[model samples]
Target: LFHTLSFFYMLSSFTSSKISYHYHFINIRKNWTEAQRFCREMYTDLATVENAKEMNNLLKSIKDLSYDVYIGLYRSNDFKWHWTLSDSFYNGEIFKNSKHISNNESCAAMDNNWKWFNDNCDSQKQFVCFNGKICY
Candidate 1:
């Protein structure tokens, strides 16, 4: 009976977590900085490409042209790249093949193959917002 109860508890937790994986797509034209702030004001900060699966999910959610979206990764005051969503350092090689180049590309997005690339934050573009909350 203990095993059965534990199994139900695990299932409930997993279901709740699944319901909270909210990565919303917002269609609007705004610079990266403004877009980042907008997301925070509305609910969460700029979204993060948490994983390839989530990235693919976003790509499918996009309806129009995949505009460059502002992510939670950016250059710090010291010029080191970091996640704006949290203090976690960005060790992921998501943008290894970017040709646009340099720290000026303050925004990140998933290109055609679920890869990350940098873009000018000031450039107006549509965005995907991530809110880790259960949507009713």
Candidate 2:
């Protein structure tokens, strides 16, 4: 209904570099850290959107355009966005989501419309998990 929807779940995946990543959606709601923990336990890490194409593909894959789901992006103490998976995939900021970010919000979630949002790390929301493999 709104951008602040409390609960929803879905998954998506793609390949990059020497890694073949498969993304999985978690239906349960959990804080960002907890989601990361769950992802690390069962998968490689939270979903990593390496570029604009991947983000767009994820949005296009989902049926609903109203859900706010967590991705692998989090704000570091250096005031930069980082992927939960390997940091090598992201060299620089492709989009300027940080200028709008604040001090309190550290984790990121992307709406179905593909807009990035910074939220409190403790806020509960649906998330995606990805497992990667070395491509041969």
The numbered model that scores best in lDDT is: 2
List candidate 1 stretches off by more than 4 Å: 1-20, 77-79, 96-103, 134-136
Model 2 Cα lDDT, one tens digit per residue, 71-105? 88777777766677775423343334466556668
Score residue 76 of candidate 2 by CA lDDT.
76
Query: Native-vs-model 2 lDDT?
Result: 0.66
C-alpha root-mean-square deviation, candidate 1 = 10.5
Model 2: how far residue 90 lies from native, Å: 4.4
Give me the overall lDDT of model 1: 0.57
Q: Quick one: best TM-score, which candidate?
A: 2
lDDT of 1 by residue, 53-72 (tens): 54456556664545455566
Clashes of each: 0, 0
